[model samples]
Target: MTVKENFELAKKAYEKWDIDIDHVFAQLKQVPISIHCWQGDDIGGFEVNQSELSGGIEVTGDYPGKATTPEELRQDIEKALSLIPGKHRINLHAIYAETDGIAVERDELEPKHFEKWVQWAKKNGLGLDFNPTLFSHEKASSGLTLSHPDKEIRQFWIDHCIASRKIGEYFGKELGTPCLTNIWIPDGYKDTPSDRLTPRRRLKESLDEIYTVKLDEKFNIDAVESKVFGIGSESYVVGSHEFYYGYALKNDKLCLLDTGHYHPTEMVSNKISSMLLYSEKLALHVSRPVRWDSDHVVTLDDELKELALEIVRNDALNRVIIGLDFFDASINRVAAWTIGTRNMIKALMLGMLMPNEHLKQLQEDGNFTERLALLEEFKTYPFGAIWDYYCETMGVPERENWLNDVKQYEKEVLSHRE
Candidate 1:
């Protein structure tokens, strides 16, 4: 049988449990996954002519064809988006501003700096998201920004964050979509600090100052991201998960959960339901981590599937904002984006295709045996057929066919980059 015939058979099988395959397809197509622009440039922004990475962040391996300019990065992103099957948004870091060959400090950034980006996003029919580049600058070399002891330095970072929120609002107003402005600072100690409370207090005060001006939520939303520890912050990280969770709840802002920002034993999937209970909305930075916070490319792993399942099962698709957050400079950048994004979409589709209501009913009735058996049976369902149908209907290449397009782009576009 052909792919469509197989999909029809699978659809009929799922109908036994009252699952609507067409509804799942319609919902999946409407979900927008924000693709991180840093992936195309290996997290090196266009703010300066730098040779090394800073702010306790590291990108290993010397991959060829890394995007060096804004135009190159956009070109690469267009190619990757062409192969992926969904409407999506682009997540931007503050350091990516096009300054017109003039030196523009972070604190002095204006909406006009990103006018080119706004135009580009409009032309491509993509929405925009923003982040404060709290690291990789001289101000952040001391392993602190908003939490720094020096009032001058802390105020500088606060001003930068405030500027970023304005830029985010501008993007949203221009593109007619709410842009999420996330603040993630790399501030901590290499050794245990006796004055931990001082830094946290400073951070709280700095955040208050940054958020003093309330922007309309229709144009922009604020989010705070946390990290367990970074390279130089192994001993202590001021903005840990608890800190952001409390801050977000108190301030009525969204808390962002980066998948690689936790201990090896902890899974972000388990935290989603709990977070949704307190916060009105939540943001996610999905990435694959091997043992530690190494920003590896995403794949169809068990945790990825579980994360997607939790979102679908809880009916929180509209409340949760999803974005990709990995940078693997060891391979082709365009292919990396295509692979990670396609796998993410695939994982979400798998979760949506599950008989979640039936499983919940079985669990509630204490029919553990049947629930386990049916779940195992679900593993063997023709999910691939439905996925292929999704790609075909969305007008994107199915499965391995996307790789051929990536390879072709590498030869025609990426390989020419010096």
Candidate 2:
């Protein structure tokens, strides 16, 4: 009937399994999904001397009203955040820096370039995350960055990454939350490499150099994201999953896993528990992949739920850093963010509602039939009711009503961008 009444009924259903409905809300509130800023601009950063989008990253569709300026991008992000349920962080790339129309080399960027961003984050009470933009630059024209054979090119990227970490540290110190500075380079060969070891060895050396400039862990945390293959590097990617996995362990860095960066059949959900066993902390770029590394918007699918279940059941919610990663220029950009982020929170909510303890006991007792049955049955539970209540409680639009807000914003704000 009403949001509260429906929530009450749903609460009773979950209570049967001894699930603390209030506790679930408390846990979910603590999770701050880092919403990627690139999505608002389709990865087109605000550099005065902007380069073409390269390095196996592609954003399709010529959607109208794409954010073209720093103020515009931040404004659009604010709009999306209003519709989202919980407090969240903004994930930014180095190219998004503002230099007052002066061309600042990536290697030369400093905290001053992002002073406005820090101020905006402070105003909004949002934590900030950082990424070293390794692609879409002249240095990466050959599709190699950290793993490039040329020592000069490798050093350039290393310098840029070092600068990025310092910026991240700035964000952390100003915002009172540690910033995650992730490094993902598009270094690979399209054709089978005659010698793969040289590139990977160079990459290892370059990483060793970058990590030498260490900031306090309380401010900036470092992460390395690996991709199996990209557009130009279908044959072999230098920073592969196995390579980064081993490197993260040895270096004590976090391995950032992108859901779209795996083989066709490989599931990120399956790897979370295993990675958690070894890594004290890991990061996730939650995006959907279709045929290849498509970087599609995340949906409320089986894999998303399973991924959330792993985090919730293993009690590693705080350990796994969750962030959204996908840019679809085809749809309303603000709506895209709203839908994907809401689904992520929804998946986590569903995971909390599950009888995880009972399910684990069933498996331990060899009760596969009951486990399977309950799992299927819970899929049709009163999940929507609880979700509606959450949105209402969090002071956002309930369900599809958020779409109306997006449409109105498109009319009032985004439509005027052109």
Candidate 3:
């Protein structure tokens, strides 16, 4: 709704209800927001801060058809900022890429090379969001067929993280502000008999080494991008909802939601609802779908998209961190970032956005009402109309573009009045 329209609604509602309607108006102030640089096409290597949005691209992982270089990772983030240059900056929290040596490994980011990334971020103005995968991709290196069983594999990863911390060491200390370190281990299940691995307890212990350090220091929490999957179509540990819920309760750390991870099935909104039940202990994010694929391109999937927003609203939460969760080998970070952002908005359908039961609880917990307003804002989106009746059980926005499309709507209403 426009500023004037919003005020008018409040006036009408307040006259009838006698509620301090303006009490809910969120102060127009900068809120600490973050976006992951998994997509390089539109928003790679760039920092989006309330102050200035510019930074280097952050690319990672070794994919079959994907190709994103350090330069691309550097450029994407830089461009995202330049696209919306202004004061009160929108800082880049960090560069997030996997640990595939083929794309990015500590060795790939040699001392000087690492400095270049940092310097670029500093120059362009952004922070870092490190993923545990940034250290190694033995799985990918081994052709994504064999799992590394050598202690060196795990130890090497630990060492790389320590090194990253040393390199990332900032504020005269090790680590950066709003720093993010993610560890998504054998997060899936095994399919065959020959595939041997450590127990979940030991695996958690291994990841805990780093988690302990940060938690002890009370540093930035490393979000666990949990998923339920298996190798060769076999299920994995963190792949199922049961495992994820168990892990969240046991780990006592933040969990990141990857929308597409539960692809092919599962209600994204329902999952969001469950997670928010444990807010302050978790975070939310999205990645585009690839193929019948575990994680692929992020095109608009009707059921999935509607469900995702409902999940957000159901959880009644805001300040949710969004990122490119696409792990396709064919696409680069820039393409990933752009597609990710576009998908975020395109997921919404227009009409009167309203909070549901889940939102009410979220509001009660968050001590805020922006969740209500956000739903209303979504109503003005162009896509809402077509989807308005798609599933009327839940309220959605009417279809109308905020600009040109809305004008036509206005004329129709005026003509009927005359």
Candidate 4:
């Protein structure tokens, strides 16, 4: 059957619940997921002097055709964007800066280093986000940056973050959308720390200094991300959730909650409502975590659905800046991006299609039996039909047709890469 034919049948089922199918499509189109560029290159950014991946994060597998240059990375991003439905933004790190073979220190980075990126973004009509690459650098060798006891070391990272914010501001001004500049550092102790307070205190002081050179909020939005634990810092992390939560609340910064940054039992979906209550805006780094904080490709799992439901039911679509953060070098890089991003959009669509108000009323009225029944029944609904229609309308290949494009591109473009 035609994609539109299947969609019509699915539409009738959803209309019974008083859901606006057209409105859902429109809303889904408007929601932009910030796709991380590092996924294309396994977090190996283009720098004259590059360092090995460290700071508790590791990208396993040697996927051939990984982007080795700025132009190639952008090209790979364009390829992935072509397969995914809807317009999205690109997230970049400080290490992606192009200095024309000149070794530019992180603190000395300027907007000129990212001019090509801004131009590329402008050409594609895409928004851009920025991050200060605090890991994989000589200064971060001690697993301490911005929280180091040495004032000079902390100052270096402070300057880098300040510089990154300015670059984000530049992106916002160029793209006409406020750029989210997030700061995530890998500063923690491998074993139990006798002086946790001291490192946290230093981190606080360093952040204070970074924000001192204030730029226009209309251009750059600031965010701070925290991790429960990491490869090296299993015992204690300086930027704990409690630390960044309080810091973000008191300082008026957006707290970015990474899905993989929590313990095995703790879910980020449960934290969304509470976070939105206090902050005007929050951000997310949507990923899948295995036994630990392993950055696995996101799937349309139960937690993903719940996370989307939380954002949709709470009516915080605009309030929450959704972004993708995962790297899997095992599969085709472009396919990895396509799979993870499409699942994210699919999760959002599922949330919109749900009878959230009805379910809420049912719960409020103590109709738990009916609520559970409906929830379970809706899982078998024609969700795939609706998703295929979305892809058709968006002019992207429907269903696994996208995989064919990836395979063709692999043979034609990616395989040629040395």
**Which regions of candidate 2 deviate over 4 angstroms?**
none
Report the number of the highest-lDDT candidate: 4
lDDT of 4 at 22: 93
Cα lDDT, all candidates: 0.91, 0.95, 0.42, 0.95
lDDT string, candidate 2, 1-418, tens digits: 8889999999899899899989999889999999999999999999999999999999999889999999999999999999999999999999999999899999999999999999999999999999999999999999999988788999999999999999999999999999999999999999999998999999999999999997999999999999999899999999999999999999999999999999989999999999998999999999999899888888999999999999999999999999989999999999999999999999999999999999999999999999999999998989998999999999999979999999999999999988
Clashing residue pairs in candidate 1 are none
lDDT of 1 by residue, 18-46 (tens): 87988998999889999999999989899
TM-score, one value per model: 0.98, 0.99, 0.58, 0.99
lDDT of 3 by residue, 1-418 (tens): 5534444554454334232223222211111224454443222332111111111112335422222455544554554333221211122222333233334444233333345555666665555555533212333342121123455655555555554443334311232455544545433334543432444444455555644444332434455655544343344442244544566577775667766555556656566555666755445555544433245556666644664456444434343444445434354333344344344444532101333444566677994677766556644433332232222212222222212422343344312331
RMSD of 4: 0.6
Model 1 Cα RMSD, 1 decimal: 1.0
Error of 3 at 390 (Å): 26
What RMSD does each model have against the real structure? 1.0, 0.7, 12.0, 0.6
Which candidate order results from sorting by lDDT in descending order? 4, 2, 1, 3
Candidate 4 per-residue C-alpha lDDT over 281-360 given as tens digits, one digit per residue, 9 for 90 to 100: 99999999998888899999999999999999999999999999999999999999999999999999999999999999
10 residues in a row with least lDDT, candidate 2: 145-154
Q: For model 2, what is the error of residue 368's alpha carbon versus the real structure, in angstroms, after optimal superposition?
A: 1.2
TM-score of 3: 0.58
